[model samples]
Target: MSLPPITSIHNPKIQRVRALLGRRSEREEQSAYVVEGVRLLEEAAAAHLHPQLLLYTPDLAPRAQQLVHTFQKAGVECLPLAPALFASVAGTESPQGLLAVLPLPASQLPSQPNFVVIADNLRDPGNLGTLLRTSAAAGAQALLLSPGCADAFSPKVVRSAMGAHFRLPMWAAAWDEIAAWIHQHSLSVFLADANLGQPYWQVNLRPPLALVIGSEAEGPGPQSAALATGYLSIPMPGGVESLNAAVAAGILLFEVARQRAAA
Candidate 1:
């Protein structure tokens, strides 16, 4: 049972997906985001996230066809689009001929999380995504994005995160909410700073701690800095100045994991 392909670019579904990919406002309005490629689709399935809509071309590879069939049988709204049309709206250079519009999962901090990551004023989608991925891998229980941070659900960030969005508890929040949450959890909050802070390794990262990484350009703002329980800096003996925001986060997060593993 083959479905008719969507050949017109003006089709409402096509237009909607294009809008979701191109505009942050549209994504927020619809409470959905677009994800492309087979690997991502597989990750979504593993995380048990059912897509609101699945679009693929008839030329999909054998494995992709199987996935489409699986979703279709599971009552997902699976549709076919012309290959060129998919390419026109796709963010990647090479289209895998599969994409989905998945609803944004509800994000909340865990009741008793031991570790959390706060990305303050992070502007780069690549860095934000890497931070999300690294935080998840390092076993942080939640992630918080400051008001000015990049859209975590943006296509670039989603793609780079490699499905961390589905697995990690994360959301954007204001400084006040962040401060309240930190205090409520009784977690020590450490701001990552290049200057005027104790060495990261010297700080106690055992558990129940929150690590904050600010923008590469401005670092954490005054409001965010004021909320920190302490400031931490990585020792760069080579005098390289500072690590990329994501790299610093990865180093500090894993150190927390390492300390807890031994405890």
Candidate 2:
């Protein structure tokens, strides 16, 4: 059942949403994040990701209204917000009619993963988000983040990812833990470097492997470099110095997929 529309900007629920939108720390502390837009909400629903709370405006279009109804029938707490109040807490320039407070999905790494992605010092949320999308599309079994990468669940990353969060297991761990996991899996670790090792296509990507992508500005840190069994460079005959981290990740990940498919 829908609660009475909240008119006050001081409402506790509104305040909680604002906090979640603004702070990564708050999200981590609560183990929840705010997800905005009809598209993301639809994806969440399709994945059977139930929300802890649903907030919407009264003037929602038919489809959005139906989405609100669906959540309501699922027994989620639905709160209607005044339009201005909704806009105030929304992360986007234009507020979507609906947003939700959802717990982070319980994604776990598989026991034996043939392919994985690791983000090393990738500070750009857009790049990291694109990497997440590409990694999921390429059938990576998991994504691991080193310390310096942007928070994967942040609003901008989440928006840029376009629902990729629901599709893969992700973890942010220390170098020690990462190295231990790689060792346990007995997987080869390859660093994607602009000028190093064999050409990416020549690499035998058929084995269980983890690809580490670093920042374009700083490249991989010592921690990541220490873990690489080898490096792979994309061939660029066009004379570009280096590709964007996310673009490089896409090219490499898809190559892995292509090679595995042909094998």
> How accurate locally, in lDDT, is each candidate?
0.90, 0.92
What lDDT tens digits, residue by residue, belong to model 1 across residues 5-61?
Answer: 999999999999999999999999999999999999999988888899999999988
Looking at model 1, how many pairs of residues clash? 0
Count steric clashes of candidate 2: 0
Candidate number achieving the greatest lDDT relative to the actual structure:
2
Q: Any residue pairs clashing in model 2, and if so which?
A: none
Error of 2 at 3 (Å): 4.3
Estimate candidate 1's alpha-carbon lDDT, on a 0 to 1 scale: 0.90
Q: Supply the TM-score for candidate 1.
A: 0.97
Q: Per-prediction RMSD in angstroms? A: 1.0, 1.1
What's the true lDDT of residue 244 in model 1? 91
CA-RMSD of model 2: 1.1
lDDT of 2 by residue, 1-263 (tens): 54677989888989999899899999999999988999999999998889999999999998899999899989999999989888888999998779999997665988988799999989999999999999999999999999988999999999999999989889999999999999999989999998898999989999999999999998888998999999999889999999999999999999999999999
